[model samples]
Target chain A: MASTRAVLIWGALAVAVIVPVAIAAHSPLLAWRSPVYIAAGLAGVVAMTLVLFQPLLVGGYLPGLPRPRGRRLHRWVGAALVTAVALHVAGLWLTSPPDVIDALLFVSPTPFSAWGVIAMWTVFAAASLAALRRRLRLRPRVWRLGHTALVMVVVLGSVVHALLIEGTMGTVSKVVLCALILAVTVKVLLDLRTWALLARSWR
Target chain B: MTREHATRRAFLATGAAAVATLATAASGLLVPARAQGLAPTPSMRGGANNYLPGAPIVERIGGGGFWMTGSVRRAGDGAPLQGVRIQIWAHTTEGHERDPHSHGATLTDAQGRFRLEMPQIVPAFGQPHGHLAYDDAAFETVFLRPVMPSSRDTSLSADFVLQPA
Candidate 1:
């Protein structure tokens, strides 16, 4: 019975995030837009939403998820985040190559473009560094510091970018999601007690 | 997990989902189209016919902003066709679709050359594209390929080769 209940809870949590985004996408302004553009925009929203999941998984905050399983899922979700970002950029590129190029070059006239680009590269960099962590033989403390720093960049940049773009995303839902993402991330960082660990090690 | 704990978890999870859904819906969040099987139109379509017949002719060359250069030609003969009318409409720097300054036209020179200057437009979403059209006496209205912005501050070029229809 408990196991069944756990499954129910997990399902509900997933639905909560998805249903809102699905409903928020139905705007009259988007009626005439192309599928490629829609896909690009949706991918960005998904990527930003995924940020909320990362901290939860890493902190083992989800009910019934073991730490090991949560960590594994965290890695998988991080990779998925990268793929979403790629698809977001690729779909946009298909719709307009010049605009994509400008965003990538950090010369786009939109303020959101630069922030989005920064978050995108930081996500890629974080993933690459994580993959090389074992090979690089870095100390856990050093790795944690670098990874935490990049995560902050990803979170801050993504939040700003999403907020600045007054596009199809429903403003209320977007703000709520962003706020949750920031709160969860900060909570996870505090739970890690990285500073405490570093200070103890130094002593 | 114990039966009691499981029940509590389920209750909390269900409550969370319900709250989120209600809040989002109350805030007017509605997804219009499903993601799958959308029949997307090609990016380039005909330019908007917003050009007034007696609209004042504007010389786009040497004006500020991005410069666009192109030539009108006969499709089959590869011959430069002079005096073709080219129309352009683009989003403003603020990304407004109804921008007045972004809509205008110019006539091809003796060498079938035309130039247009436009502001650096940034779309709120998707990609920014400039609409274009070419008109010649002997050919059907030719909509030139869209003029897109690039990474560098450089001139954009397009050539309209109109087919007789």
Candidate 2:
């Protein structure tokens, strides 16, 4: 339950960070009609960020942490993230019909849109794998490698999409998001190293 | 070969495999643009197909005004459009309406020529209280209000090119 609470809190925080930035970028305050765009952009950023961090948070890759009290929290958080991402895409589609169409068809004029769409698909792939991993009878090593690869795909695509956007959030928000991504990546790498060392020592 | 030699060879192979895996992972972290380039410059055809002329005129009132001229090409293509209408309205640097006019509208000619004549710059919102900077442009901070032109115009020219939707 505490783990679930933590995930919910983190997810909300991510949304809060993205909303103001989106409003500033889309300049919804300038016109009421533009609110939809601002909302969608904000939602997209929040969802992408949550998805990027999902694996580490679920896998407990923090430098020092106890195992989550229950798997239920992890499941709830995963479900919520999925919901958020769906809404994000839907909002984007509504706000920019042509761009969203181009992105879906992989023919967007901007590469960043392509990256965002690819990230969405990668997130879907990860979710699918999570659903099937237990039943697939795959080796643990193989599963870990594949999951890590997909997660990286999602993160890379998201970072590119975020960095390319020019809006009110501007460079400051982007830099902060990038730094957080790097920090999370370093933590994951260190956790992997620690696990490998433990396994080797045991052997 | 001694057992020690076999052990060393196995260790080297394992190390090489690990390194290869890490390299692959690192490569995966790059956005797809590294291979495809950052953005596609709009081709003439792509821009031509989406071009709408006379669609961007903000308004046309029978009075003294300022004529702002610009072209609207598809971000995907660079084609001159005809008959797009444009509506131009602006607020003063302080965010007040320029003409005290409620709205303005106009149409582009076959050459996508648009002229907006305004009596004066009105505060758009209220008044410019302070500096408004967008993407690090200070002087570019003048308050410009925009809305999509009415759908009647075939092509649209905007006083300001909107970021591609």
Candidate 3:
């Protein structure tokens, strides 16, 4: 019974990740787009899907996966997310260097570009800080708090960036995906007492 | 192993069928039409009777006469299309539709919206109609012949929803 339940949950999760991308892959606009542009777009989609998985895995929300395995998966997925983001940026640069530079410098005409740039930088920052945690010798709680804050920015920024772009993803599916990410992030943060820390800090 | 192979074969077959069906349905939309018909036509059939093949691209035309405003969007998803050329020509207070002075073009902004000023359209072929065209490689060519609601109106607008070629 538990195995059946786990399968059901995972199936739903897979659907959430797959449906929007499947629909977007069929967009006619892609017919004429450069391969690099298509790669960048696909990377963005994969990164968004990874964002949804990160909080759930760390929070031990998936039914069948044990906590240790989930944590290991979380790290692997985090690495994959960072790599996807790098590929996204590199592909965009190859397609349009001046536009990509403008996006990185936060002066792109498209409003979504600035939000995506902010989110991309925050993803790198979070990954770098986590990698340097031992060398920096930061206090455990402080490190968690800082990392949580950065991840929050990454989550919110990427969601907004995806929502603002008028792409192949339908609004309903995009909103559903984004909402799942946000709810999972909040649930994990609540379990960690991150909000309580903020409440105390505010006092 | 045999069962797994059989399932994979079924999946591949189903996927192929789906793709073939989609391609067949979309083939019609993929082929673009030029000017609706041979040009020098009337009623948005494109080819202004006196089209001066190269109208200089401008922000607004004719010094704030009648307002010509419109938007450009992708047909299926309705996403705002940017930088699409929208050509305009009309019989108006300043000149006749056949006159080159009455013809000019502008581009959609980042939001897919455009506005231009021209002398208010007057009756041409007994109706006050303004002509516009989108002749860019990025999208299928389109011609718009929007008629003014009334000749006295200060402004008229027409929008385009372009399909990918």
Candidate 4:
């Protein structure tokens, strides 16, 4: 019975992710949209989807993978997520330099631009911190606190950015992905018991 | 009342009317001229179509085996729109955005259905989005459709219902 329940849970998770993506694949706003823009849009979506996996991996939610393996995968996935983000921004830059410039400056007229930039920076910061953790000789607890905080910023900003952009991404799928990202992130953070260390640090 | 005052008043009124007319004309020019019907914005990243000027404007391709099928219909009446010229292009299976084999155009049949036989596309940008354009300039054009990849067959299908022009 327990195994059956686990299978059902995993099945639900897969459906939650796949069904939305399938729906998104069905309706693209334009039939002849430029490949570059399509690529950029796809990169953004891929990056956002990767956010969901981060929590799953970190929380050891995947059945076969042990927590150590999950952590290793989480690191690799994080790198992939960052790469996706870079490609997204770079692709957009190639398509429209002026818009990318405006977005970078945080002066783009589009509301979504600001959020995207924020998310982009946060992701970079998280990656940078991860790379520097050993060099900085930071305590594990301290590192966790900072990393967790940055991850939160990344997820929140990304969610807002994705939600705001009325682009090629199917609306229902994008929303479901964003909601799951937030929910899973929160759940993983709670499960990791980061709060206890963070709270104790305050004293 | 006085002849001089009446003439001055008439001149001022005529000047005001002329200014108003000029202002209206200027504002009309300032308003962005929309394309006939609803035309979607072009892709920012110039794709294969942008570079391939020598390519055929309309190709007699898209039939069987590996294909993309769709129907164009009137949104309100549920009527199929026949003879609508539809252009389509995608990244080739090898993932070249500029591949010629992935580009073509055809007309919809009487049933408002079109079948485009394209290469087994490898989505270079993550997921493949096939670019499309309708022949009628007066109807609003839908730009891109995310063509779902299938493992079982090298075929995909989509339907377009156009808004009233």
For residues A40-128, could you state the per-residue lDDT of candidate 1 as single tens digits? Answer: 88888888878888988999878866678999999999999999999999987876566677788876656788999999999998888
TM-score of each: 0.57, 0.52, 0.56, 0.54
Which numbered prediction scores highest in DockQ against the true structure?
1
Say which prediction, candidate 1 or candidate 2, comes out ahead on lDDT.
1
Candidate 1 vs 4: which has more DockQ: 1
Sorted by DockQ (best first), the order is 1, 4, 2, 3
Please write out the lDDT profile of model 2 over residues A1-203, one tens digit for every residue.
87787787567546645744564555523342245555665566566556545545655743333347323455565666677777867876665454467678877545567787888888778777877889998667666667667867877887777776543344565667666765676677566653464355322
The interface RMSD value for candidate 3 stands at: 18.5
Give per-residue CA lDDT, model 3, range A7-72, as digits (tens): 999999999999978876876445635566677778888899999999999888899666788888
Worst 10 residues of 1 chain B by lDDT: B37-46
lDDT of 4 at B91: 52
All models: lDDT?
A: 0.71, 0.50, 0.77, 0.70
- What's the C-alpha lDDT at position B35 in model 1? 36
lDDT of 2 at A24: 51
Q: Compute the DockQ of candidate 4.
A: 0.03
Interface RMSD of each: 10.0, 11.3, 18.5, 9.5
Task: Give one digit per residue, the lDDT tens place, for model 4 in A52-129.
Answer: 899899999887666999999999999999999999999877765655786789765456778888989988988889
The DockQ for candidate 1, computed on C-alphas, is: 0.04
| DockQ of the two-chain complex in candidate 3 | 0.01
